[model samples]
Target: MTTQTQPIQAYSLPTPNGQKVHVMLEELGVPWVYHRIDIGKGEQFAPDFLAISPNNKIPAIVDPEGPGGEPISIFESGAILKYLGLKFGQLYPTDPRQQVKVDEWLFWQVGGFGPMLGQNNHFTLYAPEKIPYAIKRYGEETLRLFRVLNTQLEGRDYIAGDYSIADIASIGWAQSWERYGATRAEHPNVIAWIERLNARPAVARGLAFGKAS
Candidate 1:
């Protein structure tokens, strides 16, 4: 069913992880269509959706123009970013050392930064009962992670050597620092970085996608 001009099909919500793929497609200036998987209504658990994203997560995609000119489905935000970057020859660095730099930060986001922040949000906002230990535990970890990000961004403009997928991966999470009990004053560098990324037209558009609709 995928014709040459059939846009990439994105199945996602507007969560931070979802926004990563959205921002990547926009940044690459690619043609894409969104299929909102309403997590609240348990749409992510649908059998068809699970076939592509077995984890039942948002932000999976099906590229009509895949590596061998066939349809390909991909899950996980980080992997999706890498695949698109490679296909487009943009954002993802080609140089070995520079590429490593981007990979380091990108994995750091997927492994540590995003998960910790998610835990912080769950405990502080979504938890059924307010547990002091969980609140304190995740709260401190969130601050620590923000500190690491701020330090990494002290002198630089982006997370890695250049404005690569590393920055794209973390921008949405960083934008929600306040929701996780962190403040701008605590991480000035991160605040500045957020502003800088948000100022970009593509990023603004990507972040705004799915919000109005």
Candidate 2:
């Protein structure tokens, strides 16, 4: 009989970036422990947290025994989601073409949508003081990203085959853009997609930190 791997211990927060792992774990229906690493006050920079996530980012995890029983620690929210989805064979496709489609959307979030909107939040709302040019630059770019998403999602329900890694990767961040004063109304498709994602019971629980006591 094949041996089972040791479960991972997750270190995370409720932020969109942090929630990727949370949602993926929920989707995977795995048993794990949560270590809430609060980045608001720089808790992630703590040496111990850094060990699991060298970048000191939330949404990192340590698999007690990975592959050949070696401890596996990883950062990067997108990578984490892909790993879990592929391992579980639940939220991602094993077929090459479908897998690539899922991966494309996942990477889009990490490189395009997430960063652009994050900057939009910074200059448009989070900056100590607003600079018109900065706000305009990021805000327009954020909308453009949304438009790209809207176009891609126009005839699709989920980003890839059924509800795969694409949906899991995008959900968390889409829910929080408004907190940064980033609006989605203009991108009607994105708005509809966000509603659908958060509507999932697993996603709802993940957003609330999953069975908090």
Candidate 3:
């Protein structure tokens, strides 16, 4: 296991993507320090933040105790989660087949669920002028993605057959279903899954981080 005298430096806000890393660190019981990169103030574009996160995103990290005991900077929420999981020998399974299952759902969330819902939010809430076509297009897509998740949870307690990073990757976005025009009535399984995750102390703390301060 990786040991560190210094906590991992997390540059992030409390957005859905940022919550993923927060939840993972909390779940793993690892030491980490938060550095808020206020996206609202365009802090992500600053040269220092951009150096690690070339895509100019809020959630990034610098690990002083990385492999070979050398410092390393990492960006992207999914990659960060994978790194932490592997380092701690937790959440992320070692068996090839089990790991593949986790990857499938993890990618599914990052690729389809998060992006489509983000677009829906952009056009529905943030667009200066609401275009009916754009709103309808993204709204429909959001519901479709929610249905996919609901179906996946039919007979399961969590995504990917266990409580892994797949759950961490999705819970942040899934909890905001109402924002994207989804109803719990239509996603009963998803709602139950959300409740199950929220019951965990680490998840509740992670999801609520930065809100009080």
- The window of 10 residues in a row where model 2 has the poorest summed lDDT is 1-10
lDDT of 1 by residue, 105-144 (tens): 9999999999998988899889999999999999999889
Assess the local accuracy of residue 188 in candidate 2 as a C-alpha lDDT between 0 and 100: 71
| TM-score of each model, paired residue for residue | 0.95, 0.89, 0.96
Candidate 3, backbone clash total: 0
Candidate 2 — what's its lDDT?
A: 0.77
How does each model score on lDDT? Answer: 0.90, 0.77, 0.91
State candidate 2's TM-score: 0.89
Give the per-residue Cα lDDT of candidate 1 at 113: 93
- Model 3 bad stretches (over 4 Å): none
- How many residue pairs clash (N, CA or C atoms closer than 3 angstroms) in each of the candidate models, in the order given? 0, 0, 0
* Model 1, position 137: C-alpha lDDT score: 96
Looking at model 1, residue 159 earns an lDDT score of 92
